[model samples]
Target: MWQKHNPARELRSLLSRIETVSQPQVGLVADVLEHACPRLKSTLGPNALVRRLIEAEAWVDLGFWLIGWELPDWAVHRLSCDDSRWSCAICVRGLALNWVEDVAEFQHEDPALAILGAFVQAQVRKAQGHGPSNVTIFRRVERSGAVSMGPEVER
Candidate 1:
C-alpha cells in the first residue's frame, strides 16, 4: 500500500528550505544594491529614475527578508490554499519593490504594507484560529530588522 501524505511534515520541510538561506548581511546588501542599481551608469536623465527605483527595490529586499520570502514555494502554497488566484507575500513584496521609487516612497502609505498586512493577518488568524484583520505585518517585519540589530522588543 502507498504511504499517506502528511501536510504538516510537508510544511515543515518547506519552512526549513525557506529558513536555511544565510541571513542578509551588510556585504550582501551592498552587492545587491550595486548590481541592481548600478550608480555609475546612471546620469541626470530618464534612466536616473529607473536606477533609483531599482536601488530602492534592492534595499527593500535586503533591508527586509524579501528574498527569503521569495524562495519558499511552500509559503506561497500555504497562503493561496483557499484561492488559487490569490498572490502571496513574496509576490506582493516584488510588486511593492517595483512600485517604490525612492527612500521617501518607502512608508506605511505604500501598497507593499497593505499586501503584507493582509498576508500577515491571514497567517496570524490561521495560527491563532482568530485575530484582528487590520493588524500590520510590517510591524513584525520591522521587528525582525530590529532583532537583526541585536535589540528585540517584547510583543
Candidate 2:
C-alpha cells in the first residue's frame, strides 16, 4: 500500500524525509512498528505488513520483544481458558509458535506470516531466533513464602 500510494513522495512533500536502512536500532524499529501497526493493518491487512517485515528479516535485526497482538477471534478463544493449552505461559508460547507455521509456505515465502503473527502474540507476546543479547524469560518463579502457587514454574 505504501508503494502504491506513494509513501516516499508523500513523505517528501509532508516531512521532507528520505528513507534510510542504515544503523536502525531495535528501539527505533520497535517505536515505528508499534505506533504504525494499527495503520499498517488498515492499509495492508494484518498479515501483509508482517509478511513484509519478516521477508526483510526485520525482527532478527531489531532483537526486539513483540507486544500488542490484535488476535484473531479463534485464537482468543484458545487463549482465554484456564484449562486451556495457554494456561502455562511457557506452554502457551510453544503452542503459539506451532500455530504460526514456522516453515516456509510454498506459495508465500520464508518464515511465514502466520509465524510472525503468532510472534506478535507471544514474544512479550513472542520471542524467536538464536541470537543472544538482551531479552530474558524468567523461567521459574519461586514464591518464597506460603503464597506459593504449588511449585516454581518454568515460564
Candidate 3:
C-alpha cells in the first residue's frame, strides 16, 4: 500500500494550483515546492510547467544547461534515502541522470531543501497507515571532496 502513494498525482495537483499565477508567483511556489519536495525541483527542469516556475525566478539561467546539453525538457522526480544531504536519487523521463553535485558550496541556502523535508514528512505520515518501514535519510558524500551532513552510506 505504501507504494501506492501517487507522487505524480500530488505533483500535478500542486502544479495546477499555480497554473494561472504570474511568473514570479509561480517561482515562489516552485521555491516552496522545491523546499517541500526536492525531487520535484529536479523533475521541473524538464517539465514545461516547472520550467515556467523556474524561469519566473529571474536569477536562474537554466537555459544554458538546457541548450548546451540538448537535454529534453521534461520532469524528473527523486525518491532518495533520508540520509541524502546534498544529492539524492533522481528519476528523469528522458534520461537516466543521477549524480551528486556540491549543493552546499552555493553561497545561499537552497529553498528546495525545505520543500523536500515537508514532502518527506507528509509521505512518511501517509505510509504509516500501511506499516511501511520508517523513512530513513542516508547522507552520501561525493568523492569530489564535498562534505555531506550525515553518516555516509556504505558502498
Candidate 4:
C-alpha cells in the first residue's frame, strides 16, 4: 500500500528546492505555495501570490500569512545578522521563547526564503507533535554534493 501523502514532507521537499532569490515562473515550489495558501487562490490564481511576494521581497508579509494560516495563535520573530543572513522563528503569543524551535530558526541569504524555511520547519514540528524535546538537526545536501548547515534549495 502506498503511504499516505504528508503535507509537511511535501512542503519540506518543495522548500529544499527553492534556492534562488528570484520568483519562480513554473515549478513544484510554486505549486506548493499555492497549495498552502488557499485564501490567495481565489484572489490570485495559482502561483501569482508567491510570484508577487517574491518579486516584491515581502518576507514579513509572507511569513505572517503563512504563520497565521498554520497556527493563528502563534507569532513570528525575525532578525537580520551582520553576516547578511536572516533568521525567522515562530512562537506562541505572549511567550517569546516558549514552544518555539531552533529548528524553525533558519538563516538564509534571502529573508523571504528564510521565513519560508522556518514556516516549513514549524509545520513539520506541528505535524510531528513534538514540543521542545527532540533536537536532531539535519543538514541539507545540495545536488552539487555541497553540505549547507543552512536551509537547502531545490532549484
Candidate 5:
C-alpha cells in the first residue's frame, strides 16, 4: 500500500513518539534535590534546570507539565516515557554546572533563550545605573517601544 504522505499526520506520528508517565507525589522532589546540595540555589539560579524542578512541584499542585513535557530540560529516549529512561538525569545534572563555570557557556539545544537572557541582563543594567539627564531609556520589553528619561546626570 502506498501512503499519501500527509505532512501533518507524519508530524503527529513523530510527536507521539514522546513519552509521559504519571506519579502520585512529585511536588517534594525539588526540595529533595535542594537538600541534596548545600549551594544548589546560588549555583543554578534562573537557569533551565532549576525551572524544571519548580515545574515538578507545581505539577502536583496544579496538575500541569506532568502530562506532557517535564519542562526546561526534558527529552525523549528509546521511544518510551519510562522513569528509568527519563532525560532529566542526563540533561540537567551537569548542564547548570557548566553555565556556572562560564556565564556564556550553555549546552542546551536552543540558543535564542541565551540571547533573550542577555537582553534581560542589559535591561537590568539600565535599571540601576547613573546616566546623563538627556539620555533616553528605551524599554524594549513592551511591543510599543517605550522611551523614558534616564538619570539626572552622568557619573
Candidate 6:
C-alpha cells in the first residue's frame, strides 16, 4: 500500500542519518530544510545561507534561522541533557486571530536537528488543524463515575 507521507517520521529518519555522519553535507541539510519549510520559497537566499551555516558548523544558528522563516515571531531551544541532546519548543500561530497557546516539542542530539524536527512537527500539526483554535475539542463529564460527552469547547 502507498501510505501518505508523514513529515514527522521523515524528520526522525533524517536526523538519525545526520547523527551518524561526521559532518552533514550542505546540500542534504539545505534540501531537508527547504522541504520542511515551504514558506521559505519566497526567499532567494536560502542556499547561500545554508552553505554559510554549514561551513561555520553552526547547528544552533541553523535551527534559529529555520525557525525565523517558519514562526518569525518567537521560538526557543534548550539543552535537555548533558549528553548534548536539545529540545525545541515553538508557539504555533494559528489561523484564528488569537494565538492558540499550543506548544510542540522535538529533541535531537544536534540542536539544529532538534529544532528542525520541532519545526516540521509544528507545521504538520498546524496544517492538519490539530490545535484547539482550529478544531472543536469534545469534552467529557463524569456522571456516576461514567464518562459522557459534554459540550464542545475550543481550547
Question: What is the Å distance of residue 36 in model 3 from its true position?
Answer: 8.0
> What digit string (tens of lDDT, one per residue) describes model 2 on residues 1-155?
33565432332221111122323334434544543244344654556655566568676322222322332111221212233112211123323345444221111121222223233333222123311223233344445553543445555
Q: Which stretches of candidate 6 lie over 4 Å from their true place?
A: 1-28, 45-47, 77-79, 82-84, 93-101, 131-155
Candidate 3 at 9: error in angstroms? 1.6
Model 2: lDDT to the true structure: 0.32
User: What lDDT, from 0 to 1, does candidate 5 have?
Assistant: 0.28
**lDDT at position 123, candidate 3:** 36
lDDT for model 1 comes to 0.32
lDDT of each: 0.32, 0.32, 0.36, 0.59, 0.28, 0.63
By TM-score, the candidates rank as 4, 6, 3, 1, 5, 2
Looking at candidate 1, the ten consecutive residues that score lowest on lDDT are: 99-108
How do all the candidates rank in terms of lDDT, highest first?
6, 4, 3, 1, 2, 5
TM-score of each: 0.20, 0.19, 0.25, 0.57, 0.19, 0.57
What digit string (tens of lDDT, one per residue) describes model 4 on residues 1-155?
Answer: 99997876765666676445444334533654654554455564435665676677565576667667555555676556548777776656654454435346666776766676666666666656743432334566666686677556555
Query: Of the candidates shown, which would achieve the greatest lDDT relative to the real structure?
Result: 6
CA lDDT, candidate 5, residue 25: 31
Clashing pairs in 5: none
Writing each residue's lDDT as its tens digit, candidate 3 over 1-155 gives 36666654564444343333333245444443443344444553556744564666532233222311221222224323333332222222433332222010111123243233223333333333421222245666776787777767666
Candidate 6's error at 87, in angstroms? 2.0
Per-residue CA lDDT of model 1 for 68-126, tens digit only, reads 33222112222232332322342322222332220011112233332333333333333
Clashes of 3: 20
Off by over 4 Å in 3: 1-4, 26-32, 35-155
Question: In every candidate, how many clashes are there?
Answer: 0, 6, 20, 6, 0, 0
Query: Which candidate, 3 or 6, has the higher TM-score?
Result: 6
| Model 5: residue 144 alpha-carbon error in angstroms | 45
